[model samples]
Target: MWKIAVGFALFAGLALYILSKGGDIDMSGEKHGADATHSEAPATAVSAPAAAPAAPAASEAK
Candidate 1:
């Protein structure tokens, strides 16, 4: 029990120290509605390779 308390204190202190060094830390937890951010990248249109010409029939070739 004592060990768990000590470990939690150390972790929390370290987390707070790091967060303090970094400005404007949002500790408000998860956001909702319009406050949420959309991390999805914009879609891109890729042009597919052109199809090869149709092969000639065996009878027509002969």
Candidate 2:
């Protein structure tokens, strides 16, 4: 039937499109394949906070 042929053609076109652009869909960071871990340093050490507190808290009631 013409409908079946059209459907098959559409599906083939969609498959080709997906296959062509599929590589860009992957997340570039921290993939298990062939790439090293995200950071050079060990995970155990914690990084210090960069931003200082804006204002000190007032504990005493007015």
Candidate 3:
């Protein structure tokens, strides 16, 4: 029936969306580790150490 087909299509779409957003992809491996470590070296030197902005001192407020 058309209703059954529609229901099945809806179910399939929902399942695919759920799985895609769930981070099911596995990227952990030796190559990934090597790439990360290799890329991090120069980045550390190029990027400044990030610091939180100083908050307004309490006494400064009225």
Best by lDDT: 1
**C-alpha lDDT of all candidate models, in order:** 0.91, 0.74, 0.76
Cα error of candidate 3 at position 49, Å: 39
lDDT tens string, model 3, 1-62? Answer: 99999999999999888879987454466664436555234444467789999999999977
Supply the TM-score for candidate 3.
0.39
Which order, best to worst by lDDT?
A: 1, 3, 2
lDDT of 2 at 30: 58
* Clash count per candidate: 0, 0, 0
Which candidate number has the best TM-score? 1
Clashing pairs in 3: none
TM-score of each: 0.43, 0.38, 0.39
Clash tally for model 2: 0
Off by over 4 Å in 2: 24-62
Alpha carbon lDDT at 14, candidate 1: 100
Model 2 poorest 10 in a row by lDDT: 24-33
Q: Order the candidates by TM-score, highest first.
A: 1, 3, 2
**Model with the higher lDDT, candidate 1 or 3:** 1
